[model samples]
Target: MKNIIITGTSRGIGFEMVKLFAEAGHNVLALSRNSKPISDLNLKNVSALSFDISDESEIVKLGGYLQTAMKKVDILINNAGYLVSKSFSELSSQEFKECYIVNVLGPATLMRTVLPFMKKDGHVVNISSMGGVQGSVKFPGLSAYSSSKGAILTLTELLAEEYKESGPSFNALAIGSVQTEMLEEAFPGLKAPLLPIEMAEYIMDFSLTGNKFYNGKILQVSSTTP
Candidate 1:
């Protein structure tokens, strides 16, 4: 069983992923800002760590903690992210910076910190969005969020190329609109978003077997298979 690290586990997709991986007997390191509700399924091999992803100091501390563990991380899931939906004109510089910090900087920093502890067969899965893909339709209030995710896509491609010789794969999953806290926060009145647990199950399965086929490709997780 692989040792996997996942961020943003307090709720939503990250929380579900922790359940899925732990149930599958993988050693899971779950990180989030708040302490997640304890689960019997996760008690076996899941560890919960709390830190704000947007804080560089906190990430550095986490890096030190993981370094001390000295165990090679088999899989790293850059799943912690946030969205602030507002028109470009309405968005402040502070908001843009905050988005960049969480969406782009946090993943990049985590990847850097974990790289030395990753084995040759390790994999890094970046959680991007359809807004990051080329030819995706533009949405007015999502400029900052889309831009950050788009940068993540580019980072994924670059890392895939950089680690090609090492045999550790890097890929990005441009998930479709899933039913999560972030979606509800973005569109409060919207109904029928995909459930977080369902999406997490799909992601866990994909991470186990789909990397060989999907490395460096943006796979969409939507209701209808394309």
Candidate 2:
């Protein structure tokens, strides 16, 4: 069984991912700002950690703790993210900075911290957005969020190239509008979005296949019937 680490497990997609992975017999290190709500599940394979991913110092401490624990992570899912919608003209500099901190720097910091402890056959899954795709239309108030996800896509490609021959794999998953807290936060008027459990299931299935065809490529997930 794989030892997987997933960030942002408090709710939504991250929470569902934790449940799915643990049920699949993998040992999951689930981290988020808050404890997972399903505390009653009592799964022996799941451990919950709480920390603010935007804080580099906290992440460094987590890295030290993991090293001391000597638990090698086979999969790293950079799933924690945020979205603050405001028109470019109305968005303050500080707001943009905060977006970058959580959406970009957090993942970068985690990847750096865990790199040394990752096994040769490890996998890195970056949760990007459909907005990151080329020529994607811009949402009026999503400049910061879109740009950050776009950067993540580039980062994924670069990492995949860097690790191509060294072992392990890096890929970016461009998720479409999924029913999650973030989506509701971005569009409060919308009645419903894609369910989190469905998305989580698809992601877990994709990861377990050991398919290299998608490595260094972006896999987009949407609710549209194929």
Candidate 3:
């Protein structure tokens, strides 16, 4: 079984993904600021850690854990996110920093720290948003969130190129609206075509098998108009 690491596992798709991987007999490291939800599951193959992606010290702590426990990582899924529905004019500098820290910097730092533990054939899947895609339909209140996600999309491509000849593949998924808490927070009363668990299932499959066929690629996963 592969040694897998997933971020933002306290709820939503990330939470569902932990269970999926563990049930499939894979060793899972579930990371979240609030680890109680996963810890309560008590899954045999899953280790739940209270992780703050924005903290450099936490990343260092995780690296030590990897060295001692999970000698190698087969998959790393950057599924954690931060968002706020505020107009561009209303978004404060601190708010923007918070969004970027979680959506871009955190993932980038995590990948750098985890690369040494991943094999050449391993996969790194970044969870982006449809709003982040260039030329896609845009929204007014997501300036900070969507722009940060866009940054991650570019980061994924650059990393894939840098490691193309040496190691693990990197890919980003620009997913459309899903019935997640984040969605409700951003666009209340809006009904999405997909559910958190449904998206989790798809993401789980891609994290395992998509690397062979795709790297430095942004897959737009949406059924609605572009």
Residue 150 of model 3, lDDT score = 96
Q: For residues 1-226, what per-residue lDDT tens digits would candidate 3 score against the true structure?
A: 9999999999989999999999999999999999999999999899999999999899989999999999999999999999999988999999999999999999999999999999899999999999999999998889999999999999999999999998799999999988988888778899999999999999999999999899999999998996
Candidate 1, 1-226: lDDT as tens digits: 9889999888889988998898899988888888556343447888887778888888788878887663679889999988999999999999998888999998898898888888767888999988877787668898889999999999999988888888578888888888788898898977645789988987888777766676676776555332
- Best by the TM-score measure: 3
lDDT per residue for candidate 2 within 109-131, as digits (tens), equals 89989888886578889898887
Model 1, position 179, has a per-residue lDDT of 78
- State in Å the error of residue 44, model 2: 1.8
- The alpha-carbon root-mean-square deviation between model 1 and the true structure, to one decimal in Å, is 2.0
Q: Which scores greater on TM-score, model 1 or model 3?
A: 3
TM-score, cand. 1 vs. native: 0.93
Per-residue lDDT, model 3, residue 92, is: 98
Give the CA lDDT, 0 to 100, for residue 220 in model 2: 75
Off by over 4 Å in 1: 38-42, 224-226
**Model 2 residue 7 distance off true place after TM-score fit, in angstroms:** 0.6
- Candidate 1 residue pairs in clash (backbone atoms < 3 Å): 179-194
Error of 1 at 97 (Å): 1.0
